[model samples]
Target: MRSIPSHHRLILAVLAGACLALASPAIGQEAEDGLEIGDAPAIMPVDPSDAGEIERGARPSSSTGDANRLDRGERDSAPPVTKGDKPMVGGEPDALQGINIYLRMGTPLPDVPPEKPYEGEPDTAYGAFQRGLFLTAVDRALPRAQLGDPAAQTLLAEIMSRGLGVKRDLKGAAFWYGQAAQGGDPAAMFKYALLLMEGKEVPQDREKADDYMRRAADAGNASAQFNWAQILVAGTPGVRGLTAAMPYYEKAAEQGIADAQYALAQVYSALKDVPAEKKARAREWMTRAARAGFDTAQLDMGLWLVNGYNGPRDYEAGYRWLSIAAARGNVVAQNRLAHLYINALGTAPDPIEAAKWYVLSRRAGLKDPGLEDFYLGLTEEQQKQAIDRANRFRRT
Candidate 1:
């Protein structure tokens, strides 16, 4: 009899690399009316061990000390906003509060998942590449490539472009990529489009690039879909652009491109015209991206969880997510974490912890006058403790 391992446990083990604790994100918001939190435990130390588990792919143990401590998702509960409480991003009646993913989307564009690993030695050119016999890979690929084999052509292009056991030749790579693209290889189409856009390797052709990108995107290439969405949004900025790009983003997101997932979260959460069902899915996508190690998504996920945006708020889960992001050295999370510490929104009020986070964010060059005022109001001894904590803080 074959024994099946627990699937949920296995999934968590796989996702542990993303620092996922599986804290419940859908806990209902608790009221803030005279909330009695003075008796709550002080900001508990974030489990430093989870970071270590990320690389080892270990199953995360639940928060320690179950006797007196409240369950994680129920501790801070959720949205604690009262009559005068402000939204996290701080804008007027209607404004985009989610951290803008556009800020860094260009520099290191989202990459597609690499080709699936080989099970055993196959007589393919890629088998040679995988075995570190790059020269043999090129030798085996060239004749098949010449015979109009798209996969072989694509492999030859990759080897040439990357200079794997051969003199690098962008022009030659571009030619092979174009040949494979013409033969309807999705990956080749994408690579060729990039070369067309770069102009250094090939003559800059925006129209040609768009055509190839669109072709690759339609062929279900995940990176192509994400880049196509970006292209559409870049062509027309604002709500209209986002709305137009939604389909591409959704497709790419479903294919597990974290950037597209983050983009979907932003547009779905922001737009009033978005269906309630789709809007509710915003946090779901954001959480996936967050668990994929998109630090910005983690920061936004914390904010979304805390504010009950797109889903029920879960302040305890949000705090933990923020802690994860802060540990990852996200300056924005550090700033927001400081607020959570000071206000007792998730953890018990701890001015020293609050000031520690503020110092970290300040060192990262984010200026927050209100946090500054709060810092100045702290006692000298408290300030020293905060500074010391910040100095000793090393991202795990």
Candidate 2:
């Protein structure tokens, strides 16, 4: 499977963190206490050509510097924040609100299926295509595409979109993708939808884009599944999209989409009115996300396990996860881990060890006056030891 791009991963982290802030009243309190909540992650627009290649399974090139060409208004508009709104602390935003999250996060486009050997004998055209002979492949496939071969049209679209052997022609690529989509190719449908949504060389038609997105998702494209779910949760007309988005999130999460796993965990955890059994499921999803390397989920899981929320307390496990997140430079995790160390929740209380983490957390711009006082109260030798530990930790 292809990896998510780094910028896309950052966006997912910011979105998850935002949703988490919405769900945790502690975040509001932290803000009021003069702690830095951190700036919202910046959105870096992706290249439109990269979007086409991603949707068609081609390797993305170093950006051609076209990221800024995308219209910011089409991509960065968030849902309106109304007057008197306190940002819905301590509960999951409803599906409609989730749409705002999706908008803010920005879509990372789609992924095409991995290349496979053609059925039975390897077709010469695809064989060349797979072997990196883009010009040869295009030469061979052009006739077939002209003869109405959906696969050939799709291949040509991929080549044109990425400028593999020819000059980039987004309009040409969109035309071929539309043809393949009309021929019932799910990948083509997805690519076409992206073009439609962006209005790049094609008229922007969100209604048609939505229809095509649903079609591609229903056809079992994992990327389509996740994107369509976001659209549903964001709401349409009078419909509450949450009831519809759940299954899609599940499908995408099970398919190993880390962002989907994180989103699912947030949805489950935010359902304040759900039964205990349902909440347990939420914890399970959160653990899945934590294991998937979502730092926010790791922090949350550690807190949940430490406090016995939604399940029995497992201080050792909590300490393990919190330590993992702290090592990755999460200040909140560092602070919490220090608390656990000082309190002897999972291990023996060691003021020196607690002081080490407290110092590190504070350096990361998290204010903890109480922890500061405690650290200052230690003996000179203990303070020296803690500072030594902190220096060693920072070196790593």
Candidate 1 least-lDDT 10 residues: 35-44
Candidate 2's residue-wise lDDT over 1-396, tens digit each? Answer: 123442113234333434454455223213211112122211112234433232223333642433322123422455555532335434645334333443456654345578976568556677778867676677777788778888888898888888876677777787788878778788877777766765646777767777877888799877777777766655431123444676777787888776677667766665455456655687778788789886667887888888886678899999988888888767788889889988898888989999999988888788898898899899999999988988888421
| Ten-residue region with minimum lDDT total, candidate 2 | 34-43
**Whole-model lDDT for model 2 versus the true structure?**
0.67
Q: What would the TM-score be for candidate 2 when compared with the true structure?
A: 0.60
List candidate 2 stretches off by more than 4 Å: 1-142, 146-148, 156-183, 192-205, 236-239, 272-279, 348-353, 378-396
TM-scores of all candidate predictions against the true structure? 0.67, 0.60
Model 2: colliding residue pairs? none
lDDT of 2 at 303: 86
RMSD to true structure for each model, in Å: 24.0, 18.9
Output the lDDT of residue 122, model 1: 68
Best by TM-score: 1
Write model 1 residue lDDT over 1-396, tens digit each, in one string. 012122101111112211122223332221111111111111111222221111111112653453222224443545554332335434444334454454335344346679988797566678878866576676677888878889988998888778766666666777788788888999988877776765655667777777888899999998888777766665655666677878988998999987778777777766668899998788889999899887767887898889886678789999988999899888888889999998898789999999999999999887889999999999999999999999999986
> Taking the candidates one at a time, how many backbone clashes does each contain?
0, 0
